[model samples]
Every structure is written in structure tokens, then in C-alpha cells.
Target: MQYTMPTIFLASGSPRRLELLKNLDLNVRQKKLPFTEKINRRLSSNKIAEEISYYKAKQAITHIKNDEILLTADTIVCKGNEILVKPRNQNEAFEFLTKLSDTSHSVITGVTMGIPNKLSTFSAETKVYFEPLSKQEIHYYVEKYKPLDKAGAYGIQEWIGWSKIFKIEGSFSNVMGLPTHMIHNYLVNWQKS
Candidate 1:
């Protein structure tokens, strides 16, 4: 008898998600998708995240195999009713940092795991409180790290998070993007069924 492992396909281009998946020790293949998602303003942040995650899966539907597992995720930062997306330029990054400083915000990551006949989607929310930051520190992070590609102009694993984040109320990995514990829980059950 021969044993085989399941193939996992990551339908995202995020280096953070890739790194987290690697930490999980799974057989994964990176397939970057031009995953452009639009927000439906009528929905809440959590629903928005899950909708985008499922959309990514729908967009990649043609490429997934029945024997392989396809995982897609989307993350967003929101305060109250406003959602902050990826910064397109330095000024925006600075503004995002300024807005996030000295406040508690929500980091929501939605994940969709697809198999042969089933597609499951869920979202994880983390409350992050940032210490009051100086203008110099905010400027330094925007210039040095160039957080243009990250949502809310920040990465939890980066210097800004280390220096400014005073408290985090949920999974740290969720703030980083992929929610490793959630995925691991799903994967363990996935392997059995």
C-alpha cells in the first residue's frame, strides 16, 4: 500500500499568507491570482471580508482539483464603520498610520477552504490597540518599510506593529493575515474527512 498527501493550492499573492502556510508544514503551491475585490458598502466588515474570500475562490474555480485543497483569504482593517484598504502611495500610508494611532481597530481576515464538493468560508476578527505614536515614528515607518502593499498600511510582523501595538485581543496570526490556528484546526478535520 502507498500513502499520499493532499495537495494544497494557495490562491493569493500575499507573502504573509505564504509564510504562514509554510509554517503550517503543508504541501502547498502558490498560485497568484489577479484577485481584485470590490467592497459592497451595504455589508459589515466581517461579511465584506468573507465575501471577498469567497469571491477569490470563485475566481479560481477553474483551476482547483477535486483531490486538492484550495484555500483563499482576504483581510481588512476597519474602525467603527470605515474600512481602510491598502495604501497606494506614501501619503496615504502616513494618513493610515496617523488614523490608526492611539485607537483600537479591528483586523478581520476571511478564509475559504474548498474541496471536492464543499467550500467553507469563515472570518476571524482581532482587536488591536495602538499606542499613541509620534509623527516622526509614523513618518519613519512609512518611508523605511514602504508599507504600500499591505492593508491599512501595516503588517503586524513589521517594525510598526512591534513598536506601536500596545495590545492585541485575538490570534496574532490573524492580524498578520492567515489566522494559522484557525486554518490548522480546519486542516486537521479536513484530513480526516
Candidate 2:
């Protein structure tokens, strides 16, 4: 059979993901799905991200054409087994960042690539170490960054990430929201087959 390159459909509202894909110079289009991540506490941290991506992919299936593949993802922060998602308000954002202050946490980005007959899912995990943040600093970030839209009340590419993050032990882009290296490898190899 002849292989035809599938048009890429990005099913996420995150500007970070959009920029990452665009930066890679991939032929991609953005269409956000109704995917507010609903966490199942029973699952592991990495599994939570992967499962949410699967749900997002399923929701986006209707928008995909026969010659297109839908890409969806969910990112979460894990401090031990506790999962921190997007905050609902500034106060919550305050609390989330405070908890992450001066500690090591895992940022997991789960991804799904859905085609006509198959769905492939995987997750990338990055270990991020944060410096001790003062109350004023946390408040300042919440006020200035408006981090309610981001997972764990923070964006690794934003001010807090630049200032407060001390170290990262894995894919930097994964902490930003998408794992570009992994995604690129998949796109390259997937296109080949």
C-alpha cells in the first residue's frame, strides 16, 4: 500500500503546545476539544496524563478526517502520588505553587496520536526542582502570570520557571507542555510506516 502523510490535527487549547508544534515546522492545525482533565486517583501519575490524552483523542475523533491524525495531550504535576492540575482560581493557584515550593516534582505530559484505525499513547516525565519561594513571590506570580490556565498553576516557560525552577532532570519541553523530541521522533517514524 502507498503511504500518504496524514494532516496533523492538534486537539488542545494550550498555546504552549501550539507553539511547540509550529516551531517544529510540522503541517499542523489547532482545534481544542472539550477535555477538562478528570483525574482518577487510582491511576499512577504517568497513567493519569496518558488516560486523559486518550479521552481527548476520543472527543476529537469526530473532527478528524480519513486522511488526518488527531494529536491530544494532558499534563499534570506529581509530588509523590498527589496530582496537581490546573487551578480554578488565584487562591488555588497560590496554594498549588506553595506546595511545590522548594521541592522536587514530576511533570508528566501524556500524548495520544489517533488515526483512522488506531490510537497510540505515551507519556514523558520531567523532574523539576523548585527553589524555596516566599509568600510574596508566589502571590506575585499568581497575580502577574495568571497561572490558572496552566497545569500545576505554572508554566515552565514563564517567569516562575525562569526564576523559581532550580533544575530539571528530563525533557525541558515536556515540562513546558509537550515533549518535542519524542513527538518529533514519533512523527518521523510514524510517517515512514
Clashing pairs in 1: none
Question: Candidate 2 — what's its lDDT?
Answer: 0.88
**CA-only RMSD, every prediction:** 2.1, 2.7
Each candidate structure's TM-score, on Cα atoms with residue i matched to residue i, is 0.94, 0.94
Most lDDT-accurate candidate = 1
Report clash pairs, candidate 2. Answer: none
Candidate 2 stretches greater than 4 Å from native:
1-6
Error of 2 at 118 (Å): 1.2
TM-score of 1: 0.94
| lDDT tens digits, residue span 73-131, model 1 | 99999988989989989999999989999999999999999774588999999999999
Residue 57 of candidate 2: its Cα lDDT?
87
Please list the residue runs of candidate 1 whose C-alpha ends up more than 4 Å from where it truly belongs after superposition: 1-5
